[model samples]
Target: MLAKPAMAAIWVNQYTGEVMGKYDRPAVFKVASAAHRRLFGKSKAEGAFGAITGKLAIGITTIALLMIIISGLIVWRPSKGHVRNKFKISITKGTYKFLYDFHCVGGAVSALIITVCILTGLNWSFGWYRKLLYSTFGTEVAETTSHKTPAENFPAWDYAYSKLSSEYPDKEIRMYQNEADIVVGGCGNQQATDTYKINPANGEVSSVTTYEDKAESNHIKGWIYSLHVGSWLGWLTKIIYLVCVLIGAVLPITGYYLWIKRLILKKCHSA
Candidate 1:
């Protein structure tokens, strides 16, 4: 619930005079997000324990994951000068050979991409990490936002729609009254959308903010978000990320097989 804002967006066909609306997210998304971020559904803030409420659980998992990646890479490191051997997947050798090679080689490659996703992701899992990013990048921390009611010149539905339609052409725009902004969707990254405030009296739209306009810490954070989700290079990185994620999903099962196999071998030797 911390990061999940359940807001429905309505779409209007200006020319046809038809309204289309639906839930912005799927029903399972709420539970999944809670499980992923907060873990126990406790942290009210994004901060993982504040020392974050709910994030402590995820922070522990994050630390463990970082350790796993580091250890995994060290184990995968080649001995001697046989670097070529490390990259091989021996299909004709045998089933075990093929599985082991795939697990080792695929996992080694997947680890780099997953490591990037994890490090960038940890920025949100802890407060100090975020500050570290700010200081490292020579940027000041962003100020916390507070809600304010929209001004009395609140944009009329038709008035705001007319202006926004042109401003973000072919994009889905949704106006939020309490937040006093129009969120323009489909800017590539989920967090990369642009927001604008409108003055209905004169049909004027003012800049609320856009990801591209962000500077210093916030701008770096946008980069972090893009890198985490693999949107920086558009489709190419996204495709690589997808393949790595799929391989990553298979890693644990392969690891378990190897582990059990080793245990049985040890038992046989002991007997």
Candidate 2:
């Protein structure tokens, strides 16, 4: 993702009706090169490349959606022979059934929430998406990241768990490692929807909490996260998310083969 921006920047600076010598190219590259230097130290090229490729995921996702839409349209439209024949292939019927199912069913199932997630994530990856979702959701969430040094007096996770358990006696603490630099503290009710965050360093409760305090609340969004990640609700949500992801993944593979089977492979077979 960062790599896409860096590469795009490099291309724009180099071409875009601009003229420059090799010396100037290195100088222009230096702008992106500095981000590289910061991330990968002396290995400037790798840093720049990483930034671009990370952001490139959104572009790939967008392209995938476009392909699915086109394939879906082909599946939806009628064949030329249909008008002349009394009985013909329905848009929803055929021998290459999985292909149509892959595009239509898979797409209809995953399109809404996944698209929102992807589009918002693209904004999130770029900083703009956070603002947009936050604004639209009409909630002021603390999206800002914070950090604190581990306490010398206690283990961070143990401290967090003890503190959270004491704070909400009914809640159970679940501490998870979040990347290399951070420890995540989660507290949820034993049989309820409420979740809270705790700061590992000082055992102080953190403000960036996610929970369903009562029935019929913003926890619907919280449930979406649970549904998406398969953590909050139960085995059912997990299985549903896993199956949806699998279906979504298969769409491209099956759709591609379907396209080739109809457009190219079938021709070759007949010939």
Candidate 3:
């Protein structure tokens, strides 16, 4: 369900104003569809795969970009004066230029992915995506049943935090409770309360990053959720994620327009 690669095909076609020959579209869609089936399952594939894949693609691409810039610099150094010299710039300089584009232009064009990631993440913060992911991942996700509230409930967030801390005795707790009916977990070998959430009435300690109590060790989801939501960074972190999401949406739209303009220019020149 990689949307980056999917969008790339669409962009390539649109930029050239030429559809892929029949064989190519089927091949591309086939691979995409298969991946979707594997990751999200047949239900997601048959229904909203396009939208889901498109959104997820943007996020995956955006994350890769941070490293791609560094990798590009390492790989494409032209000062050694190999084939890259035909571009008539030093390897280091050319590599830098290319990386700058890879960072800026590539990020700009793929901002849609970030946008989708943020929005979908926000959506996932709700019960809907949680259920979807749980089912997709084959985790035993229980639906919140309408049970009577016990009059003898402890302070949900505080008690849950204590319980998690006592139970794990290793990982730090963060964001024990938020506006939504969900708990979230976070990073650090040492304890940090900022990355957790606690359910008040039932002592349901759900981590946005983890539905149940994790071990003393951190999981990838725990780390990624911390990084993506900026829970690790404080209020400034949330602000940064918000800003990045807004800017990410801008990048893809602008890139689309830029590509269109270039297409126009190319057509005019040919004419």
- Which one wins by lDDT: 1 or 2? 1
**Highest lDDT: which candidate?**
1
Question: Can you give the TM-score per candidate against the true fold?
Answer: 0.75, 0.48, 0.33
The order by descending lDDT is 1, 2, 3
Q: Of models 1 and 3, which has the larger lDDT?
A: 1
* TM-score of predicted structure 1: 0.75
lDDT (Cα, tens digit) per residue for candidate 2, span 30-98:
555543223223332244324445455544655467566656655555467653332232356765764
lDDT of each: 0.69, 0.47, 0.45
Candidate 3 at residue 110, lDDT? 40
lDDT of 1 by residue, 100-213 (tens): 898899889899899898888788788898788788888876654323343333346467767777766777665544223433324444445466666556545665777566
Alpha-carbon RMSD, candidate 1 = 5.0
lDDT (10s digit) by residue, model 3, range 145-262? 2232322232554466566677666654342224122233343311222333345665664554434454322333344346545666567666766776565545445546656766
